[model samples]
Target: MSILAALTPAPTTNETEWSVGDLAAALRRTLEDAFGHVRLRGEISGYRGQHGSGHAYFSLKDGTARIDAVVWKGTFNRLRQKPKEGLEVVATGRITTFAGKSSYQIVIESLEPAGIGAWMALLEERKRVLAAEGLFAPEAKRPIPYLPGVVGIVTSPTGAVIRDILHRLEDRFPRHVLVWPVRVQGEGAAEEVAAAIRGFNALTPGGPIPRPDLLIVARGGGSIEDLWAFNEEVVVRAAFAGTIPLISAVGHETDTTLIDHVSDRRAPTPTGAAEMAVPVRTDLMAQVDDLARRQGGAILRKLERERTDLRALLRAMPDADAFLAAKRQRLDLAEARLRPALAGNAGAYRARFGQVIERLSRHPPALALARARARLAAIDHRPRTAMVHGLARRADAVAALGRLLGSLGYRAVLARGYALVRDEDGLPLRGVAGLAPGQRLRVEFADGTATVRTEDGGPLAGTEPAPRTPRRAPRRAAKPADPAGAGTGEAAGEAAAGDPARGRRAAKAEGAPEDTPAARQGSLF
Candidate 1:
């Protein structure tokens, strides 16, 4: 019923019936030997991890038949398309048995998408993931070197791709190309291509082998499967991360890869990449020659124009000697006329100056000023003398007026033994008729005042009684004063009768000398 049993000699009669463990062990060996390193194409299902054991457990199913598969972590990690449920893929591994469970399973060493559709789906998913990371943005793209001294290329060394690039570079501008041989397709191709790109980048500048200024990851045109290595995330990221400018020439112009989008530039073919790296030698030479000729022609034209301008300037300029001679002649003629004209002007000026001097001498301001000075000096003392005399006279008159005022003052009358009497209201009593017997009174002397009580007998002992004079009757109409001295006597008698103080003043004035005509005139003034 089994390969092990069929291969044995009927298990030999002496052989005891195999134990369950032994049978399982024998069966595992038989299964492994018969189906070792088999390839299976199926849709993945029930995929699970090896649970930290660095392995994966899954079931590969095609309709009814299904097989359990296990891929070790090492193999699983290396797989370009990792195992996922519902994905159709081709799994290549050895068939092995799990004795504990008594089950047969394929130990997958490698895995790939089963068809173009699966591959495309995986490719699109990868593209989206990397695109979200901004890896494929136009701004991320670097500019390819216009001319590289050394060009690094990553592709299959045996393929026509490498030859084509080399030949293209030779046809254009020959360059030192470093070829990093790598598998462009098949298993492990992605890793090789990615590693090659990184290896080229890791090279030290100015080393034994000069670091490439530009890089080219190229492969001949092929189907998507044949070209899928270039689309790998590892390859695309390597190209994107490389410092050197990279040009990706993968497959035909119509066939696109992830590297094409990530690389600095994309070429339709490997030859195109070579062309992008360097320009044609002959074309560059021709350009340099053309530029040199153009520059020379420009210089010659400029020099010729400058020469013609110099000649025109020379023609326009007058002869220096003739110009100087004409100026000299004008100077001589001006000088010849200037002598006599200056003499005539000087003589005329002298005559006019003499006339001005004569007129000035006739009405000399200095002489007039001297006369005015003498007159001012003569009058200056007169006004000063007059001011002094007038001041002295004014002072004398002020002193006389002060003495007169003092004699007329009330204090002067009090000093002459006269006392002023006032009632309680501070008013001088003109008569004793208004006084009451007990009313208070104040008597003012020249020095001070005393308070006293009014009585029928007048004030107290310290006070003096007021003179009792009968009240005067109303005066009859009196004759106007006569102009002569005769009427003065009658007027004086009448005044004395009315007011004794006025009569005393008039008698004192009359006792003085009569004024003469000159004295009267002086007093009038």
Candidate 2:
């Protein structure tokens, strides 16, 4: 055979030509069949976190070689040891080829630290990480409540740890315990435990299920693998972030866990945690009774001492009658002198009365008083009369001025037969010159005002004049007079404006207002 023919295998009847997808699928099946299950030891690499789908995508890398790896959501959640970057783990799964990526990957069903050394190294690394975040700081630890009303326990309900804690608590102090049952070990145990811790804290105070004041995360004695859940970073973080004070009691006394370091208190056993949660009720009651006894005894002794002091003070005081004897003698002496002193006072008063009467007889105060009263009455009457006369004169003058003003004001003049004509601007029209055809004028009559217009542009706007008999001599009609100006008392060199004839009336008058410019002086009343 030729070298090419020897190197190549001949095609079978079932497999003649393979498409790309068919070839890839065939390869994937072959790989699965070849390595159905295997253990791989490699350091995890390029792991950020789980994807949104809950599947983890990372790679298993040795010193010089690497291979893609994946954990399905189901298997990932059930993983006892979660994958982390740079963690050397022994992954057990089947090797397979993904046709879409044209790459081979291991579908890890289970994973664990490779050995004791690997686990210790990972634990130390996690501890350092959490410590750097201050989760394990001493200052962050909370003080456990002295007497908590509610105690929340995070543990397996079926375990002896809970029973032991209950018994111990009953022996010490009975409290309302809220048991949040969670798996103590195995897959997903850490998550359940952490969730239980957070769940206890999420409770609202005074709610149906009250919020616990203290939290006890307890488990029976176990191997490191069995106790690993309490050491999980989630559990530690949940305990540290919780507002309730937490006591960690995982494994035996010698077995230390990460939760122990982060918890507010640590116990050697479950029973120890219960004891730390509350004090002995009987002991407390006894102490209170003792204090009451001591207080009562002290008060009695104080009362006794005060009573003795009061007795001593009373013995040192003088008798009541002896203290009042001198006062009684002084009272008697004052009583004896009172009547004699009263008689002398009466005699002196009598002498003073006689002297006063003699003085009055020499000069009678009534006559002098009468003169003074008469002078006062005369003085009083004089001013009163003068004031009355002055006020009367003033009133008369005001009345006269009011009468004169009434004669000048427009209200009364409008009552008479006069009519006041004003232009559109409210100014008095004093002459007949501005009267034009179609021009408007306000003629105020005695009753009310009326608007009128001149059609012929004359004073007699709408009337025709009757012919008058021709006069032999044209007699000049008399001109009206001007009233005397204020304080003049007379019109100088002017005749009185005689009243118009009763039988005739003029059509218009010039240089005259119906009344003067002083508006409403006498019209107020």
Candidate 3:
């Protein structure tokens, strides 16, 4: 008996039994009394997010036990930490039974991690995941430029971190700065910070807005819970994928985050990032001035040394007339040899030019042009001849395929001599599977078809078979053979080619199977 029936009172002349709903209600109240308020700690399981009704449903499970759990819309909204699979949480709520499902559930009013240690375990697991992906690798870091033209800062506009970075930059070599205002903490803060990083990278270099040469993601010091947005996977991944170099100064010198590991450089403070971005302006100017003075002094000393060397060489120089006498003698000697050399070169060049003219005459341009024309005329007719031959070959292939299709046709088999069996519905029957005693069947022979009835037990079994005579009681006929004008070869083929309805009617009248087209197809199958 069902539990309801067991709980219900038996009917009497003046008594009544409990309804199903009333019995279920009683059980629900009994459950509440036994477990009205309780606290459970277990790892969450099967959490696929919230239902449309804003209710969250999942199960709390331990090594060998599992119980259904739910957080109502109001309770879920007020929860400090949302439920997630594999997270061990402490649930404070009341136990209740739902009649609709005939199951028990814990209606959670509050949910949180089991303890501070659980939060650390979760954070460590997330860190390992990010590190395994190579996002925190040393090779992933890019060098920060010594002097950036523009700096893009990602932080809250109203925060002290931004103010510190700006003030520090002004004291050093001041440069262009672009600020991307974003929430440093709270809901969706991680996503906004990531978008800011990507936005800085996406700027067209020479467009209306200049892309940042360096990026700084800074935030004032905060507790671990407040700094969680910087440690989020999205923030870490954005910093890793960004083309611009970045310095992460999320918290104080002692605080660390995932973004710090992935960023190009990690600064101890916001001011420290600014100092790393540029050099001191006054120091740089003084260094440049000193190098300029050294360069000028070296040039003056080289000019004075050259002037002194020229004066010493003048003291050892020869007389002007003596110097010119040898040059005049050399000029007179060169003029005498010049005319003979020019005449000899003229004769050699004339002979070479004559040889070239003779070669040109041997192979004239006109003869070459005539041979090319002849070859061109020979090639022009080949295409038309080839096309005619190709068409003839294709036509032959088509005719051969047509012959192949005809030889393989089923009609060719029917014209040879087989028969087929069909049911009353004109559907082919391979066996006696659905047949019963007194069932009508169609027997199609090569020439025509006939109607017959199953007898005895069925078509395939009986002590004696039905006689080959009409089912009609008023008349009897002889056993059938091939009818007149119908037999094995051409006669049967002609009979089958005639009206099919006429053959079916004749078969019905004689009550015998006839040869038809399909039957003559000698069992090709």
Candidate 4:
């Protein structure tokens, strides 16, 4: 057989031939069937997206070969990591034929970085873009509330993450928690989480679903691929824009995501997030109890101090009846003394008036007698009226003096809150200069007397004496000789003869002259 004839198989007589369109359709089916699902690792190239349609067209190329890739608008929009030129990525989708172009290409359903290095590069790029806009600034972070009345949680409802949070909250401090169910991982996890955050923020404050004061976005520990949802820009931006404070508890302590930086607070686990939401009820109650006890003690102490001061004040007040009786006795004595003086002064004035009248009668001329008669008529009741007015004035003066005396009395001064301080000699101390520390004294109040001692050179209302100092010796004076001038001449002669010391002694003893140095000098001179 010929080589050409052997390569070609004999056609069946009843077989049908495919048209151009039919052959293309059949080829597409064959491609889909052969590679319904595939993963290609290569550097992306020739990447472009239709702005209007939102579809992405790209090429994957390596050292050996290259292939065309297409991502539908919906799938492109849903992708966690977008395809970029020069990025080494893994494209996952089924192979299909484009009938119009007669070409086979990958219809990408999902795309990701090919390895840890590629993934980290993509992550860092995304972080840079967001951080440039101030989304990750420390100043942009909000403070988490110490106690939230309603805490909204964005996590999978069925996972241990939610249960752990709830159990931890109940253990520390029970709070009202509202759970917004979301997928924690996989294809649309990021969208669900971001939407949940927005929904919580959009709620009216007093709506049927009470608005949360705080939010917690959490998921259990997982690999980086599993935790990639939290690293999505959608989730991070949503957390950053949220008005309510958010706590991110995405994975184990070692695992970090973009959302952790944007969130108000970061917790290593869901249970830790719960613990940070509110304080312990028992601890708060204990603090309140301690404050109440301290307040009560302070009030009691103040009342006791006031009571003691009041008792001391009462003891210092004088006896009212005895003080008034003494004043009455003094007033009666003053009245008796005033009456005799007024009578004697009036008698002397009356006799002087009579003598003036007799003198006027002796010098009566014709015109003088007429004027005298008029004067006598005018003076008829003048003496009696004068006597009565004088007596009234004296009485008023006595009453005024009595009032003045009462005001000046020691009892009155004591009643007005003054005390009399007497020294050891029983003499009233009138000035502070007379006081000395360690000296005993009597303090007389209106009602009673107290024995006190000086402290710091001032008398205090206490019994303890201040520390004592050495007493000074008393000065002696020279005695005078008999007033017979016995030693006067001798002392003067001795002083004049230059024996000044002996002369001074003799002069001082005889009292002949002052023993001052100036007098001695004068006698010598």
Candidate 5:
């Protein structure tokens, strides 16, 4: 006989003198005691959780039979995972007979999920639906700007992800990091995360925080069910519609979620997201200073060019010839009138003219002609000499300019000391920051051209090393704005010198230190 069959009541006395309630109660107690700690294997047919209590009511069933089951608050709290309808489970509990109701129930001690192929399929289907919407399209993603003003992070406040993000941001950007803390997984987690995203977007009046420029949606890596909140429609929609650009950094590099598809960008990890959001302040500032210097130099050069042209034109002008031409024309007209007035006194005038001619002969007009010729020659020589001097000065200036350019590292290729390597598109390989070794590249120099390969080492060692020559540093590269003061050595030094007290204050106020290289460079810029 089965153990259950053995537990059945012995043959009852014919019509025993006992009330139904009392006898039923006794039977219920006996059955409860007997079946305590028994284990059952079945699929769930119905499941319901109490709203105000941690109790679950469900039915455990095989294809042919079903049994009522109840998980008490204490047991429910101890469950490692949630239970759903139609889930296969191995349940441990005792059988309890409800006396008055004439029903049997299983009081569950522990329960665990089993054979969730259908749930996995459901998850896959949901993923496909979202993927079809271009949520997972690579081209739809954006790159988070380096060094954002504020970062909005959404994740469970108590989880390790939040701590990781906070710690990374402190070590990296150390800027204003606003958190929209929410549950990361399970039942209403999706809704909570979505609501947090929406709140950050709204950034209402009198709110404790400002709207962030970038949003980080993150969580530690976990199972599919544990990461279900990120896969929910609410969370995905929030990420897509929120005004702030979002970085979906929900799990490890291999882990992807619906939130990743809808977000502006996807980072492999929470730390990566933090890194992407901010640039090194020092680099930014250097760029700004470089731009400023270039602009100032260009303006100076333009002014000098205008001044030189004006001076050349002034020197080439024929001031003396123009002045003497007008005087000569007037003298000619006077001599023509004097010829007509001399008609009547011709003989006397002739005698007088003869005497005057004798006097003019002594000091002939050739003398004045010679003087005018000398003055013209002097004027001609002055302008020509000025032009020659100006040419010489300009040549010297051009030479100086060339030297300056060379000192700025522009002439290394010309001297065969170094050669520029470019791609097919002619973009120079200035640094190997991104290129792979063994890639084909075009090498160009003043004398000739050669194709080269990028060796798997630091810089290449060629036929002979060039002698070291000290060169003046090039004018700093410029940018629209000093990348908020990042990338400059001077700015970093100043920040180091002055930020001690301020850093302490900032750390206390914002969980980060002050005088970040980027921030310092920004100040300089």
Candidate 6:
């Protein structure tokens, strides 16, 4: 065989050719078989709807990837809340290629909202509409009583949410719970919730049903759409307008709904709502005990203090005899303090008083006088003898006294027919320094008064008057040498003379007189 014939096959005249559509269809069937139960998660875009059948078609996309998605009437019927633009969702379906159209589409069985972004958008829209009608207002939310009599529960009867709440309520609080079971999701869920709430309201007084003190609308955890029934406008309006207080407990701890904001109270979960509904029995018992103890302790302490005060008053009281006894005790205590000094001086005081009486009796002045009279009677009896004796002795004493007094003062000399010279006033002109020759002065004598002239030209001529000399001799007579001679003395005779001029002249020649300047007189000199 040639080299070309060995490598190449014989060509046929006519052969069947498959179209692009046919090829795609075959591949699509294989894909459906492989991934029919698969799920896809992405942001929906370019959404389209079939008119009457409730079918929706949209594309799921990422930054660099895309997938076609569709939700048929059955799945759409179960959606409690409709989807919107820019919503993130998870579509559970199989990826299958359409061979006839040469395109792939996701056969979605169910759909759910994806993230907090979409959930928050639904929440905000619900809030805006419900808030305008006063659903989230303080006036619309009814206050929950601290201890409720009966609580109405609107939740799934078979869910863990209901079991947890029941267990918690009975464990912590034992209030009665009446269940109002309802579908918490899918189509018509919002209306079911509203109907249940309205039913509770109708059961109030003057009706054929029992009225509950409070209502708790609760559910278990899921995605946002699972809790979307509580976020519905129907549920929000019913919660606000209901007569009883409503508490919304939906989803997990992190989830929030429009019902939560509008209801009287919101709990993180259904169990939390039950816990809030009633008070714990154990705690109430403890409170009662504590109050009883406090009241008892306060009363006991008051009684104890009163008892102690009464006892102290009784001990501090005074009896009738206390006054007399107190005075006697005080006298005894005083004597005890003074007893040492009194005991040592008692004998001495008696003896000293006796000696004083004896002395007074023996040394009486009358006794001395009697003795003196006896001595005089013993003397010679002569009248002249007594007088001569007395006179002679008096004369001797008078002579001595005269000499002594003369040395002591010059008053006696002035008294002996002498006058004291002075200026025109009675002031003595003691020196030529102050004397004027034509100035007339008085000479004072013991017997008479004479006027004398002052020598002119000295301090007295040019200036005011000079100070007076103070002779200052006392006029008292000197004491006699003997006691019997005093009245008969020559010194007494000279003192009676009163002459002063001789004394004045003698003093004038003896230098300048040391005298104080005279004081100015009101009368002229």
Pick by TM-score: which candidate is best?
A: 1
Alpha-carbon RMSD to native, per candidate:
14.2, 15.7, 37.1, 30.3, 45.3, 20.6
Error of 5 at 247 (Å): 2.2
Q: Estimate, for each residue in 172-253, the C-alpha lDDT of model 4 and write its tens digit.
A: 7898999999999899899999999999999999999899999999999987889999999889888888899999999999
**Tens-digit lDDT track of model 3 for 403-500:** 43443354444444556667788877644555788988777665787788877423454544323342321222333333332322332233224544
Q: After superposition, how far is residue 201 of candidate 1 from its true place, in Å?
A: 2.9
Candidate 1, 414-524: lDDT as tens digits: 564557777788876655555678888787777898888865633455766443343332332344433233224444444456576644433323332222222221221
lDDT tens string, model 5, 1-525?
A: 799899998886777687898888888888877776788888887676654676788889998888898887876765644567777877877888876578898888866555457446556777788788876677766666666777888887886788877787776547888887787766567888889888888986345767687888888888765776787676877777777778888878998777877788788998887777776455667888999999999999999999999999999887987979999999999998887767756878789989998989998899989999999987986888899999987776566445434433434323433455676677764454455678777766657777766666344455432333433222222332222333233322332344544223322222222232222212211
User: Model 6, 40-141: lDDT tens per residue?
Assistant: 778888875554667887789878899877777887766654545567877777788765557889977776677778677767876887678766778666
Query: What's the TM-score of each model vs. the native?
Result: 0.57, 0.54, 0.46, 0.57, 0.45, 0.46
Model 6 misplaced regions, further than 4 Å:
1-10, 13-25, 48-54, 97-100, 171-173, 182-195, 202-209, 220-229, 251-254, 268-271, 280-525
- Mark the regions of model 2 whose C-alpha exceeds 4 Å error after superposition: 1-77, 82-108, 346-525
Worst 10-residue lDDT window for candidate 6 reads 516-525
Candidate 4 — which residues are off by over 4 angstroms? 1-31, 51-54, 97-104, 307-525
lDDT of the structure predicted as candidate 4: 0.80
Total clashing pairs for each candidate: 1, 1, 14, 2, 22, 16
Q: Estimate the TM-score for candidate 1.
A: 0.57
> What lDDT does model 3 reach?
0.78
Q: Global lDDT of each model?
A: 0.80, 0.80, 0.78, 0.80, 0.69, 0.72
Report lDDT (Cα) of residue 493, candidate 5.
Answer: 32
Model 2, span 405-486: residue lDDT tens: 5544565556655557777888866555557778887777667878878565544657554433422211234443323241
